[model samples]
Target: MQKKSALGIMVLAILFVSVNLRPAISSIGPLLDTIRADLSLSSSEVSLLTSVPVFCMGLFAPLAVVFNKKLGLKNSIAILVAAIGLFTLLRGILPTYPVLLISAFFIGLSIAIISPLLSAMIKRNFPTRTASLIGVYSFGMGLGATLAAGLTGVFYSVAGWPIALASWGLLAIAAILLWLRVKEPVAEVSELPLEGAASVSPWKNRRAWYMLLFFGFQSALFFSVITWLAPIAIEKGMSILVAGAVLTVMSTVQIACNLSIPLLLERWPSRHLWIMVSLGFGAAGVLLLMFADMIFIWPAAICIGITLGGLFPLALLMPLDENKTADDVNSWSSMIQSGGYIISALTPFTIGLFYDRFQNHMISLSLFLGFIAILTVFAFLLNKKPESAGE
Candidate 1:
C-alpha cells in the first residue's frame, strides 16, 4: 500500500512536469504574428525564435544524468522546475530580442533536464509500469499542447501574449511544490565518472545511432507541423478560430491515439509494426492535406495526430529498451534527443526557407513529410530485432 501511494504521487509529479513541456514553445505558433509584429521581426527570425526551446531540449538533455547524479532526482527536479518557472516568467518580461533569445535558451535547457530524467526515473522505479506510466505522461504533454493551442487565443484576448506566455510559468511553481512531497526512488548510483560517460562514445553502437536518426527525422515532421499547421490553415483561408478548432480537433484525436497505443504495444511487443504504422499514418495525412481541399482537413489532422501520438512515446521507450541502468537510458536519451532535435530545430527554418524561396507549400511540405516517412522505415528496420543491452 505504501509503495502504491508513492508510485501514485510520482506518477502525478511526472504528469505535472510533462504538462509544461510543450506549452512554453507550442503556444508561440499561434501567436507568431503578434510576437513578430510587436518585435518588428521577420518570418525567418520568428521561425528561429520558435525553434530555440527545441534546440535546448536536445543540447541540454544529455547533461541531465550528470545533474541527477550530483543533486539526486528530488533536488534536481525541484531546481529544474524552479528554473523553468523563473525563465518562463522572464520570457514574458523581456523587452528586447536578445533577452528573449537568451530566455528561450534557458527555458529549453530546463526542459531538457527534466525530459530524460523523468523517463529514467520511471524506468528505475516503475519497471513494470514504464509503458503505462509514460503513456499517461506523454498524454499530459499532448494535453499541454492542446491547451496551448486552445487557450492561447483566450489568454491573448484577456491579458495579452506576454501574460499568456507568463501564465505557463505558474505551472512550474505548482509542479515544484507538489514534487517536493514525493519520496524519491533509489536507483543504483552511477559508476561511470562524468568524463568517462562523456567519452563513452555514442558511435560505438550502430543500432543506437540508427535509432537516433529515426527519432530525429520523425521529430522534424512533428515539430514542423506543430509550428506551422495552424498558420497554414489560416493562410489557406481559414479563420483563426477555425484554425484553433482544427488544432483542438487534432489534439483530441491525438489523445485518443495516445491512450490506445500503450495497450497495443503491450499486446504486440514488436515495435517495428507500430513504427511503420506511425510513419504510414503521417505520410497519408500529409499527402491528403497536400491534395485534398478544406473538406479533408480534419481527417488529415486526425491521421497526423494518431501517428505522432504513437511515435513520440515509442521513441522514449526505445532508450529504456536498450539500457539496463538509469545512466544508460539518460545517455541514450541525450544522444537521441540531441541528434533528433538538432534535425528538428532545422525543420521549421528549413520549411520556412523553402517556402520563402518557392513561395509555395506543395512541393516543399511534401518533400519534408516524405523524407520523414522514409527515415522512419529505416529506423524501424534496425530496431526490428531486439537489440537493447538489457534485452
Candidate 2:
C-alpha cells in the first residue's frame, strides 16, 4: 500500500511538472499583441522575448544531467521545480521589457533542467512501462500547450496579459509541492553505478548526435507554429476568438494523437515512417494556412497539432529506445535536448525577422515549413538506417 501510494505521488508529480513546462512558452502567442503594445516592442522584440526561454531550454538542458548525477533525480527535480516556480512567478511582476526578457531566459533554463530529468526518472522508475509512461508525459505536455493557447487567451481577454502570465506560475508551485511528496524507490538508486558514476560519456556516441538533430529540428517546427499559428489565422482574416479556437482544436487533436501513437509504435518495427508522416501532415498544415482559404484552416490546424504530438514524443523516446543504461539515456537526453532546444530558440525569432524584413508571412511560413519537411525526410532516412537502432 505504501509503495502504491508513493508510486501514485510520483506519477502525479511527473504529470504536474509536464503540464507546466510548455505554458510558459505557449502563453506568449495569445498575449503577444498586448505584450508588444504595452511594452512598445518591435516585431523582432516580440519574437525574441518569446524565443529566449526556448533558447535557454537548449542552453541549460545539458546542466540537468550533471545535477542529476550529483543530486539524484529526486532532489534534482525538486530543486529545478522550485527554480521554475520562482522564475515563472518573477515573470509576472517584472517591471520592464528587459526584465521580462531576462526572466524568460531563467524560466527557460529552469524548465530545461526539468525536461531531461523527467525522462531519465521514468526510465529509472518504470523500466517496463517506459513507452506508455512517456506517452502520458507527452500527453501532459500537449495539454499544457493546449491550455496556454485556449485558457491564456480567455484570461488575457478577461484580466489582461500580466494576470495571464502570473496565473501560469501557479502551476509551477503546484508541481513543486507535488514533487515534494515523492520518495525515490530503492530500485531507482540500484540502477546507477555507485563507483565513478561520472565516467560514462554519452557524447561519444554518433547516435546521440543524430537524436540531437532530430529532436532539435522537430522542436523548431513545433514552436514555430505554436508561436505564430494564431496570428497567422488572424492575418488571414479570422477573428481573434476564431483564431484562438483554431489553436485549441489543434491542441485537442494533438492530445488525441499523442495518446494513440505509442500503442501504434509498439506494433511497428520502425517509427521512422510515422515521423515522416507527421512532417507531411505538418507541411500540409503550413501550406494550407499559407495559401488556402478560411474554410481549410481548421483541418490544417488539426494536422499540425496532431503531427507534432507524435513527432515531439518520438524525439524524446529515441534516446530511451537506444540506451541500455539510465546514465546513457541521461547523456543522450541532455545532448539531444540541448541541441534541439538551441535550434528551437532561434526559430520564432528567425521567422519573425523574415516577416519584419519582407512583411510577407507566406514566404516565411513556406520556407520554415518546407525546411522542417526536408529535415523530417532526412531524419526519417537517418532514423530508419539500421545504425539508428540500439545495440
By lDDT, the best candidate is 2
* CA RMSD, predictions in order: 3.5, 3.3
Candidate that scores best on TM-score: 2
Instruction: Give the C-alpha lDDT of model 2.
Output: 0.76
Candidate 2: tens digits of C-alpha lDDT, residues 275-353: 8788788888878878889889999988888788888767777867876766666656666777788977898898888
Global local distance difference test of model 1: 0.75
- TM-score for predicted model 1 compared with the true structure: 0.86
Instruction: Summarize candidate 1's per-residue lDDT along 8-31 as a digit string, tens digits.
Output: 888898888888888877777777
Q: Give the alpha-carbon lDDT of every model.
A: 0.75, 0.76
Model 1: how large is the Cα RMSD against the reference?
3.5
Which stretches of candidate 2 lie above 4 Å from their native place? Answer: 65-75, 184-208, 320-329, 383-391
Pairing residues by index, what is the TM-score of model 2?
0.88
